[model samples]
Target chain A: MTDPTALSCPAPAAETERVLLGHGSGGRLMAELLRDVIATELGTDPIAEDAAVVDTGTAEVVTSTDSFVVTPRFFPGGDIGSLAVHGTINDLAMRGARPVALTLAYIVEEGLPLDELRAITASAARAAATAGVPIVTGDTKVVQRGAADGVYVTTTGIGVRHPDATPSAAHGRPGDLVLLSGPIALHGTAILSARESLGFESEIASDSRPLHALVAAMLDAGGPDVHTLRDPTRGGLASALNELAETSSIGVDITEDAVPVPPLAAAACELLGLDPLHVANEGCLVAFVAPTAAEAVLHAMHTRPEGAGARVIGSLTDEHPGRVHMRTMLGGVRVVDMLVGEQLPRIC
Target chain B: MTDPTALSCPAPAAETERVLLGHGSGGRLMAELLRDVIATELGTDPIAEDAAVVDTGTAEVVTSTDSFVVTPRFFPGGDIGSLAVHGTINDLAMRGARPVALTLAYIVEEGLPLDELRAITASAARAAATAGVPIVTGDTKVVQRGAADGVYVTTTGIGVRHPDATPSAAHGRPGDLVLLSGPIALHGTAILSARESLGFESEIASDSRPLHALVAAMLDAGGPDVHTLRDPTRGGLASALNELAETSSIGVDITEDAVPVPPLAAAACELLGLDPLHVANEGCLVAFVAPTAAEAVLHAMHTRPEGAGARVIGSLTDEHPGRVHMRTMLGGVRVVDMLVGEQLPRIC
Candidate 1:
């Protein structure tokens, strides 16, 4: 027989077996461990199952998956469970697919209380219902104490994309009109101020939202005139816009005054030595429209409560391809760069 | 303007911010972060045309997504990148979908060497090509140096599901023959032996594979007789069987003699105090077939290279719903339990 050491599981208290950054590496190591131990043992699929089953339809279906690893597990307006469903659905909606079914995969730490899990699950179900999506499948697994945080949920969603929809970074072209679905920075600021370090509170709360309805409306009003659609997520507006600029090999021009920045977000950015344009925003979208159709697109976005705050924030440019130059309040220009670092890591 | 304290990003470099178990909790805290930050900011709906354009689909497609968080990033048979793609494609095929497009989301640490990132990406691309899956959309961001491992990849895949085929856990029924597509435990044993503390030398390599072809064969052969299908992932065969038993609410009686075991896997398991039954198998599958169609199913599986080691490992029983029993080589009965803790982390 092999030495007992060779057969042992990592002890929760053992410093050597402690969690490392490599645990998150999307490498063979993570795959093997998850498959052989956690997933198989948990009675779930070891290989990821993002889009498993979908009904064929006239509206082409699009599916998206997201894993939430935000700290605290609770915040101002929403929690992880709700976020899991909404985030994935929004990903599909961006492709102009009406959100449909969802699968929730939860990795819960052993010591997590039943109440919390139940609450999260309940919230997830509720969120799905609220967004007109169904949580058709789910899985739960327990990690050894200290092996993980309370719980981590990976949500996979399937939706139907509109036939005329052509949404991707590469589709951006010079002279496209850039529009905002709503105000920026509320979500990031609310969560930040909630932190103990700041111990500050305001009317501000996360601007979490579901975008399927909003997307449906925009697509309906704009038809094929919409050149691109994206929800500014991790790296926020700057990072997301920068990616599009580079992909389409076009420059973008945005006016600081034109972009909607709620006062709360503005106040928070001033103190943090950060740029509001660079800060993160949820419940907001950046759309590139045919310059001629910009007015119609703006009108369509305003049709929804979530998009009421929407406005024309910028436009694509032929000069300075692959650059994003923001117009300051003083009418001067400043370049927007991808977040020097994620606006907040582990935020999602 | 807010004070500097209020301006600071919620996730500071404080030791507490490094990582807390609460971060994984699927509660309100986690949700708001994802909704407001990750999903809201970077993942804007690309269909809006102002942000970016993402393809919905033209052909039937299969898509899957998973995050890698295994403790070790390297194993004997593979590393994280290769495993990421294989695990992904395998999932797509399990749904009988032919994989085509993939989206890679990467979270990198600030201080990671450029070479490591390049290497992992290359490996991922190679694996995708090998499986005939191309990664057309990707997103990358860097976290603080210590916030994450060198990198973590979350791959979302899209493929076309097999026509006229239905595969779901709910499909399993009573009195069905069970077929294991390949020899098991190569993945588990390889990872176990590769542990730093339990160092042992064995030719054991992870059984990671893309099982689309294998899936196709069994479906074609079984025709209408195939009742259910599943890929034993994370916890190994025992966990998978246990989960299926619970889901199907049926008893599973397997003959140790009928289950194919590679000599190396068996020897390694014995030496390491691990049960080969609880080990993970990637390039493997467990199919349930009606008694009348069992022969055709077996014949179809063995015809394929991936199924050469296929065997009739067991059958479902109507009695003792939601339980599993094993007939040992000595004609003894034993219960197989889901894995309690990780046997080896990241054995995908």
Candidate 2:
């Protein structure tokens, strides 16, 4: 039987900064958050689809687990529950493995309210189902009232890396073309303004979403050109791009006109004095494509529903190694520095 | 090049009721504050040493990664830098894998002092050297002032799991005897009391030593009968026991007389009004042994220099499934429930 307190989670009104565990509810935002930031940071590892198969045939697979404790688990479109699954699944994916199974673990505070937990569980189940991934195993424990905020989830995803893809964030190159599956900053702005404190509106919503399907689409479509794929998150666009640029010892240049920033987000950024490019986005991806296959890879990204907003935000350049630059809409150039801090703490 | 302010992370301590990102900074207490409580609440997942390999043979290998964000960076016995290495190494150890390489990623705040970061890096080097693990690859980025606390480290450990015995947290059984490696609460108490403001000390240093050696020794001595092994960290002894009870569908009865509480720790707890069992301990283990092999396991645990204080904390029983009972010194019995709330917020 479900604990009564575990299920009844309250919904804090938008813009309160008074986030509850429901935000990390693993509903939608969690997945979106993973899709946005962590995936970008991961670049590539072997990953499993919904579940990964460690084809050791007879060996019992070993798995490591983690939890997302970012505040404001619930943001514009998603929560923590879905984030947990995607995050785990993506971790397995980075290993270039097919995820075979996931073990879910949750730590809920005493007064979290049972309904909220049930909602999170339901969301987790739904996400796992959508990804065709099954939770398979789980454990739950309750912390005293003040010990935990609401709920924190840890998942261990076990998968078998594919033989063909030796993916890793460490393996980018100077000649690669940087491709973005979509826009930037929507996720961060959506959550920040949603709090009612920022009080800016452009119909901005969090881009928190799942990108396994898009990942699969990219892997299949771009294969060799898809040297590395990552989702820009916490430190947002600047951090993600900087990592890739530094790793490859390459310079990156993007056209501002080509990068998609929703009208609402652009306006919101000006009001809050935040750089839209530096804001976090959940569902977008940045890919390092082989220069020769850049066009084909862009086509593949555009083909996927998740990648419909696909565009070439930037490309590798040789002149300024380990540097990133952008052409402003004003037709002038600006040096895009790596993010020095998180724009929004625990937006994920 | 590191930023001039790369390590100068300082902000007047805030008097807020809720949490902030500093709690996740690897600087000091993030792990103790979060992982400790979370672990106590959830217990152990599986563990691997070296690399998480599973007969992948000469071709494929098992690898895992993690990030540590304990606040304070520097604490009584250790810092976030060393803790990160220990954590990654322990994770590999849990898989019975030998750690080969690590990728260290740092997100530093702009204007952080160079000396502080240099010290942290040196500590990381020291930790890696002590653990016999090397940092082969690394990535560093600077965030704007408020984007990051001071510095955060994310280390991805690559390891090969042990061959003979495949251990996991799921392996605990009904008749297993629970053994604690040594005195508890040292790590937790020392960190909290050592704070400048708290200014209370009983020469209670944190037990923040690495446990791979102890675990390695245990693996050599006990093998399979040591059904499950876990380091009872943030959540302390009570929470770990509760997890075992629930997972193994068994009851655990621990004699208060049998549990060791250091004299100073007792006094500190009395003053703090915190239970020693519920406090965090960075360096300790709770080993589950089969009834027939319990004595052998304890003998082996006590054999190690680190395990000199090893003791039989409890045993599994058929009644009160998933519940833990403790016999008080007064001969009264009480339920030892899971840790409910956060004991000390920024204690690692």
Candidate 3:
């Protein structure tokens, strides 16, 4: 007799008998994997937010974790070490939390140079110090050569939620204005350039940085009016906006001309047959704010170096719920769907 | 002209130019790598304890993170899923805390079976439910084939410390009684048997179980007198004892005859020419208790199923600080040193 309590997992489709690289691309396939497999068993919705907020009886705590597997380890602007710190920090910031401490665990492959490991750790430490968050504890494990890549870092962060902040993707309302924190695609373009040896001029560097301070400023300015905050990471801006739309049951109308895309990144994306909106951004955020507080939040964001290029690129609407539409520069409308599969694998 | 703030990293020695498989064995080589590379660059000691306790203003919070890369995924008793959950819970329990929440992250390799992934998630969820802790948040990433073995799960846990409990490795003092919660070597031998296809007659299952409930019982029986608690993992009892000695500046003298080693595990270890003392255990813990309260704690521990085989294995002394000696069954005293290199890789 089959146990009723045992989960009856469906077999993978013929096309997906085994996991493909696309399943980790933070795109449509990844979403399907989470919805069909992980979420059904774990009993929690995984796509709702970047961090989980838990009440610890005495105080509300927010926790976020990410694994860094970016190839090349070292890039034009930041190494894997710093990227690991900034990634989790940014996740906490998106939830309007003050990150307190972090735990780092490393899986190093056999035969990795000690000098390289030192450089990575030092860079990580410096990033933590700059963000004022100490790495309190850590674990190290080594795998045999050929069993693992050079190194993989997994970092988890603990933070205290801002008192007046209740930002969430589900909180976006029809009248909210969507804001872009800065230019997109720089981080992804830089990594791809380095990996492919594209020799692109202008030396586009990754915008890898911690965004907690900028988040603090916006929270201070908008208070409870900030409806949603998200970083356009793996699947990038299009994925983030579509997620917000689905979660809030609202429609997003973004103007292509209003989106901030650096000329270098835009050109690189065009040449590489990539969509800038679908390319990842390491140190940028997209915010949905009440129209009344949108101007003030944008002004506050502009005061910070990380958010100097902040702009209002879209607005939520009730016409087409759970969808995102882009107003092209040529005055035509187009649906902006989530990327279907892996575009750039191991790009943080 | 050296940059003042740049970390002064030493070059790798000729014989150790690259990381070896031994570096992740939780043995001597791992310690050297930590001391010479990781600790110096991160600017924090990584070997002091299992979990790092932090003051959260309202209450004390204990946090621990571990990356699980156990090969074969499934074993006789438990899978990597339950092991990941139990491992972090044990770390929290070692510090006398009540584990409240957990975060799970996965790094999967391409081509992994979806059925395997589903089984792992279901097992992990069941483990978390059994332990009364919720996996509150999670992240999943995929690496290309050969970049990762199959799947690596990293779990981070948060728990609230008991008000009356102040257990620490540094708190062990002379005359404290050393207690072993249960039999040793079962977990390591089970993994080895599965990995090497060794046809041992008895199925020595891995003793992977959550130890929080047992720990709570010990605390209740001997609050404020449970000097220290440590799970015998990775480098097993010998490494754990050496670490406690170094941290407490005390010596431990254990009686080999008094220690609990299941006959099946002993036979298997003997067959493989491995020391049961240095073999890893997942469910067992070693505790240092004040002499006056030792009997009460042991009695309390025995009442629990997980600790049914509890025994007084040793006592602390001031004779040789930072050393461990075992009174052999033949009435001869022998020194027990930490394992020098890889004994069993990815055991937990």
The per-model lDDT (C-alpha) reads 0.67, 0.62, 0.80
Docking quality category of candidate 3 according to DockQ thresholds: incorrect
Alpha carbon RMSD to native, model 3: 18.0
* TM-score of model 1 vs. true structure: 0.78
RMSD of 1: 11.2
lDDT, candidate 3, at B160: 74
Interface quality of candidate 3 as DockQ: 0.11
Native interface contacts kept by each candidate, as a fraction: 0.07, 0.03, 0.25
> Pairs clashing in candidate 3?
none
- Among the numbered candidates, top lDDT falls to 3
lDDT of 3 by residue, A170-250 (tens): 789999999999999999899888888888534899999999999999999999999889998877798778777877899
| Candidate achieving the largest TM-score | 3
Q: What docking tier does model 2 reach?
A: incorrect
Question: TM-score, B chain, candidate 1?
Answer: 0.79
Instruction: Flag regions of model 3 displaced more than 4 Å.
Output: A1-58, B1-58
